[model samples]
Target: MNNDKKIRRSRNRLIAGVCAGIAEYFKINPWVIRGLFIILLLIPHIQFVTICIYVVLLAILPAPKGSFFENFRAHFGEQGRAASAEHKQRSTSTSNRRIIKDVREHDIH
Candidate 1:
C-alpha cells in the first residue's frame, strides 16, 4: 500500500491522473474522486472552478519515469508497470520474445 504523503500523477490515468493520484494517496478508489469531480463540474457555479483546479493539479503533479514516447510504445498499462517494477526488477535469462508467423489487423474479442 502507498504509505507516503507525497502525491504524484498515476500512470494509469484516464485523463491527467489528478483524481487517480489523489485517490492513490488516500488509498481510495480513483472512481470516487472522479465521481466527485463530475458532480462538482455539473454545478453551474462551480464548473469553471472545478476545471481550473483539475488543470492546475495536472500541471503541478509529476508523471512517472519513462518518457512519453516510451510509454506510448510500452506493452502494458499502469498495473503491469507497477507489478513489474515491484516484483520483477530484471528480465530473466530465459526471457525471449515470441515471433508470430502471420500478422494482420482485425477485431479482437
Candidate 2:
C-alpha cells in the first residue's frame, strides 16, 4: 500500500468537498463524513461550532485539479475535443478564401 496520499478536495463534492477530502484520506465513504456533520449540527449547542468547523475546512482544503466547468464537462465525455477539432478544420478552410471586402486608400508602406 502506498502511503503518499494527500488530502485534497474531491471533484464529486455536493458542497465544498471538505468532508469528501477527509473521507478520502480516511478511506471511507463521503456520506459518512456528511452524516457526521449533520448529526453534530442537530445537537443544540454544537450547531454553531459545526458550521464554523465546516467553513474552516472549506477554506483550508485545496481544490481538485482542473476548473469546475472542466470537471463538469468531463462527465459528458470527449465531445468538446471532437467539436474543437471540427471547428478548427472548418475555420482554416474558410479563412483560406481571404475575401477582400474593401480596398483601403491609406496603405502604410
Candidate 3:
C-alpha cells in the first residue's frame, strides 16, 4: 500500500501542485481534481471562497523532495548554477543602470 502522507507534485503541476498532490494521494486522475476546482470556481456564491481555499492549500503543501525540475537540473551538473548566476548578474546590472539613470535625472533638475 502507498504511504498516506501527501506531498506536492512537481511533475504535473500547473501552478503550485496542490491539486496534483491531492490527486496522487487519493489515487485519482489529476484532471478530475482540476475539473472539480473549475466547477467550484463557476459557482457565483462560492467562487471567492474556493479561490481562497485553493490559495491556502497551495501555501500549506510541501513540495516533493528531488522532484522533476530539481532532478533535471541535477542531471546537468553546473549548468543550472551557471544559469542562476547569470540571471542574478543580469538583474543586478539592470538595477544599477536604473539607479544611475535616476541619479543623472536628479542631477539634471
Candidate number that wins on lDDT, 1 or 3: 1
Looking at candidate 2, the ten consecutive residues that score lowest on lDDT are 68-77
| Model 2 residue 55 CA deviation in Å | 0.6
Instruction: Please give, for residues 1-109, the per-residue lDDT of candidate 2 as tens digits.
Output: 2379777788778987889878888888999999999999999999999999989887677677686744775765488888889888988897566788778788688
lDDT of 1 by residue, 30-105 (tens): 9999999999999999999999999999878766557583375364567688887866654543455465887888
- Candidate 2 accuracy as TM-score: 0.58
lDDT of each: 0.80, 0.82, 0.78
| Model 3 lDDT tens row, 1-109 | 2686656654578987888888988888999999999999999999999999998887676557777655664667588788899988988785556443444334554
The TM-score between candidate 1 and the true structure equals 0.57
Root-mean-square deviation of every model:
14.4, 9.8, 7.6
Please rank every candidate by TM-score, starting with the best. 2, 1, 3
Clashes of 3: 0
Q: Provide the clashing-pair count of each candidate structure.
A: 0, 0, 0
> Model 1, which residues run further than 4 Å from truth?
1-5, 67-109
Query: Candidate 3, after superposition: displacement of residue 1 in Å?
Result: 8.3
